[model samples]
Target chain A: MLIVDRVSKKFNVNGKEKIAVDNVSVKIKKGETVCIVGPNGAGKTTTVKICSGFVSPDSGNVYYDSISLLNRKKYLEKISVLFEGIRSINWALTPLENMEYLSGLRGIKKNKKDIEKYIEMFELGDYKNQQCNSLSRGNQQKVAIACCLCLETDAVFMDEPTLGLDMEISHKIIKILKTYAQTNKKIFVITTHDSDFIEEIADKVLIIEKGKIMFEGSCEEFKAVQNTNTFKEAYLKYRGVL
Target chain B: MKRVITVFLNELKYSFIILNRYRINWMFGLSNLFLSVLFLNLGIKSFGNYVTENVLDLKLTQMIIGLFVFIVIAEGLNNIISKITQAKQSGVLEQIIVNPLGSKYIFVIKFFADFVIVFISIAIIIPLTMIITSKIISFNIYKLIILLIPLLFCTLGVGLILGGATLVFKKLQSATHLMQFLILTLMVIPSYPITPYSFLPITVESMAINKVFSSQISLSFGLLAFLYAHSFAYFILGLLVYSKFEDYAKTKGILGHY
Candidate 1:
């Protein structure tokens, strides 16, 4: 289980203090996929960074399996993160090399068969040996996401994972992630604006705006917010855009 | 312990891939080093026509030794900042900084990997320089290797200091270039038996390297001990400065930005 207890972050811009995450707390049990949906600058990325042990939170602590993440160096071994707009893997290296190096960097020693499983699963067998920079943006994103899952960490945080993916590949990813979450029993936290992704993969949804979470609940409960048949209408209504 | 070893091994593989992929660049750099050494030797030897044969011979030998030390130490001093800047531009700096073994360990592992490459390049360049200059100055292999331990530490220390500064303030090309010029000056300075300039970074090590190659001057135990102590001091200071800068970068959340 992962617990973010009242985490807050503040940034200074041009000598003015701006709150990025405002006392936000969240909990995710093992095998659960939680999606954080928010507009740009809604602090979704900051929240994810704090949970992933990349960025330190100012006011609160994050606990993974009841162990505090604050000042805990080993906590990083248990998590993997794919930040938005960042390839997260070395572009100068091939996908296979990246997988090996990244996993080794994280202290995991997976066999060739286990590593090749993800390579084939992502349909990257053809380009696994090619430099990642030579691949198309969608394929590059696939490699990045595959690198994350191949680590087999206890907690996986992906920010805008499907941003550059085509519809076909996006659906394939959703299927893969859904199955992976179920079988692995790991904490999966994602931040994206893709409604289909949110609807299909998220067991729980967090709608954040202006650094604060406006709503948090199950998929069905979030959809029932406006008595609507579609997740889009319910989300629009809750965001005051209807 | 296993994690450290894994990180080290992977770092070697990663460095190898990069080196292999950019073979042309590596070759070009090696050629550049050779040509620079050749030109430097010829430039200094131009005055050889006026001096006595023995004086010119000694002068040229000292010049070659100083240039060799300069080339070797310069690689260690310049590699860390270049590596960090390249990683930052390529969007992989954040991943490296967040390595589970801690960023410090990862950087050290990378330093060792780069040092291996540097060592190999030097092995190639040393023979090439000797053949081109027709100066077969034999160095004591044992003493040379022993002396390099402190020199490598000094290089790593300075590299870390520059690397930490790069974490917060990116784009340090001009600064690094200036540093290279200063290092060149400090490297070629005449070594006094007891001079205050020995306290400067890379000075004592350069003097010691010159001594290793010069048959006339023998290295003293006190000098070797001082070199180790001084180099380790810089290493420790560099680690502290780097840690502070890393924390500041994490606080500001600019580690991934350009």
Candidate 2:
């Protein structure tokens, strides 16, 4: 289980104090896929950054099981993150080399079988040896996803994982993430605006706006909040559009 | 310890793979280094007979040693800052920062790997320079190595300081270039027994290399120990300052920002 307790962060923009994340808290159980949906500047990315220890919170702590994430080695060992809108992988390296090298950084020795499995799963066998920069954007996204998932950490935080992906690739990734979450008992906290992704993969949904969570519940309950069946309708009704 | 070694080797391998992929960049960088050395030699030769023969020869040797020291120290000091800046702009800095093995150690390993690559380039450049200039420069290989190892340690420490500043400051290219210029200027100052220049970074090492090559003075154990001590001190200081800057970056949530 992962718990984020009363986390808050403030940033200075244009020499003015701006609250990016404010007194937010969340708890996610193992094997659960939780999607955070919000408008622009809703503090979703900041929250993920804080939990991943890339950013420090001003007033809260994150924990895995019963251990505080202040312990960097344990925190890093248990979590992996994919930041939004960036080429996180080394552009100069082939996808296979990146997988091996990144996993090696965590002290995880991937066997040949594991390498082949990821290759087949991501359909990267054809492009595994190509430099990531040479691959198409969707393929590059797949490689980045594979590199992160290959770590197999207990908690995975991904921000906008399907940002530039096409419908076909996005669905494939959604299916892979759904199955991975189901079988591995890992906690996935993703921030996205993709309704299909949320409908297909999220077990629970968090609606955040203006640095505060407006709603938090199962998909069914979230839709029922507006007495609707479709996630789009429910979201629109909640935002006073329907 | 084993994990550290693995990270180091993996980083080294990754660097080599990248270097191989960008062979053109490698070639160009080598050409640049070679041209610098060649021009310096040619320029010195053009100044022949301007001074007494003995004085001219001594000045040439000193200048060559000074230039060589500048190159090595520049590599040691600027490599980390450049790596950090590149990583930051490319969005890979955060990934490395969140490594379970600790990002700082990974960078140090990266520096060591880069140093190895630089050393290889130096090996190639040395002979090429020697061949082209017909300058069979000679030095006590053992003493030179002894002097350089610690000097690299010190330069790397200073590099870490600049690298740490790059982390927080985010735009330090001009500052680093200025620093490189300052180091180049310092390289020209001859060693003195009790001068303030002796205490500046790399000054002693530069003089010591000149001493070994010219056979002017024998290096004592005390002096060698002092070099080691000075280098290690800067290295430790660099690590501490880097950690502090890293903390500030994390607090500011600017690790991924420009």
Candidate 3:
């Protein structure tokens, strides 16, 4: 389980301070899939980064199973991250090379067979040897997912995992993630504005507005609210737009 | 300690892969080879003219030693500037910053990688210089190796300092050009006798280069040791400055500023 306590992050823009994340606290239990929904600049990415220890918060702390998250090597090893950008992987290397290199970094000392399993699982077998830059956006996302799952960490942080993916590929990714969550009991924390995807996969939903959590509940409870039939309506209602 | 080594190995692996993928290593090697030949020819021509004119009583081996020092300094500075600039452009800088490793480790690995590349170029240039000018110049391998160390340290130290500056200024063009010019002046001005200029500038330049090329003193090894110590001092100082500025850099979102 991960607990975020009163975390705040601020950045200076042209000598002016802008708060990206307010004093917000959240707890994510083990074996659960939580989706955070927010518009652009709503501090979703910043919160994700703080939780992942990529960016230190201006105040408060993050604890993973009662241990401070700052500079904790063991905690980091248990988490895998896929940031929003699709080009995070080295584009010059072939997909196979990329996977091999990352797996090596993670101390996976196996050969082609183990890597081939991930390639087949992600449906990337045909493009396994191709350079990442040459692959289509959807295919590149598959490679990124394969890289993340290769580590097979207990918890995964995916920011906009399905961004730029086609419907067919998106469904495949969701199905895989659902199956992984059920079988491995891995905790998946995803931040996205894609309500359809969230509705399909997320067990719980947290709506954030202007760096604050406006609402938090089960997806079913969220849908039971009047005019909350769609994730978009729920988001709009939380944003006070309706 | 193991984690530091792990991060170091990762950086080295990534740098080697990137270097090969972009073909920069091969390009740098080829260019260094071409320039070393060109410069050696120019140095030989100038030395031959000096010998005919009876301008100095130095042996051919002595002239070759001087030319070797000049090439090492020149190529060392060039390699440093280009590598740092390319790293900035390649998004490697930002990637290193985000990792759990400290900035000092990143700078050190980058410096060592560039230093190795420069050292390889120097190795090639030295042998080629020996071959092409063998008829005119003799070789003293031990003296050559001894003279090369201080020059390499000085150049590497200055390169890292400038690289840290690149992170601050976010553009390496001006800093790199100025460094190249400064290195050239340091090499060429000292080749002439030290007495012709104003006493102050001459004294300053002489002391600075001597500090860099400490082995020239030929006394106890204290001066050479001091030079090495000072090189590390500058390296640490650069690391500190980079670490402090990195916080501001993150706020400015300047990790990708280049």
Q: Chain B, candidate 2: TM?
A: 0.92
For residues A1-242, what per-residue lDDT tens digits would candidate 2 score against the true structure?
A: 89999998998888998898888898899999999998889899999999898998888899998678789888888899899433788877888888898887666777767876887888999998898889988888888888899988899999999987899989998988898899888999999989889999999998888778888998889888789988888888888888
Better of 1 and 3 by DockQ: 1
Which residue pairs of candidate 2 clash?
none
Cα lDDT tens digits for candidate 2, B1-258: 888778777777877888888889999988998888878877877787576777667766766666677778888777888888988887678778888877777778888988888888877887777677666687668877898888888888888888988889977766676887778766657654637777777777777777667666688887888788878888898899998999899988888888
Better of 1 and 3 by lDDT: 1
Model 2's C-alpha root-mean-square deviation from the true structure amounts to: 1.9
Candidate 1 lDDT over B104-203, as tens digits, reads 6677678888888887888888877778777788878898887888888887888888898998888764478788788887776665475888878788
How high is each candidate's TM-score?
Answer: 0.95, 0.95, 0.78
* Candidate with the greatest lDDT versus the true structure: 2
Q: How close is candidate 3 to the true structure, as a TM-score?
A: 0.78
Clashing pairs in 1: none
TM-score of 1: 0.95
The lowest-lDDT stretch of 10 consecutive residues in candidate 1 chain B is: B185-194
The most accurate candidate by DockQ is: 2
Rank order by lDDT, top first?
2, 1, 3
By DockQ: ranked, best first: 2, 1, 3
Model 3 CA lDDT for position A112: 84
Alpha-carbon deviation at B178 in model 2, angstroms: 3.3
CA error at residue B99 for candidate 1, angstroms: 1.4
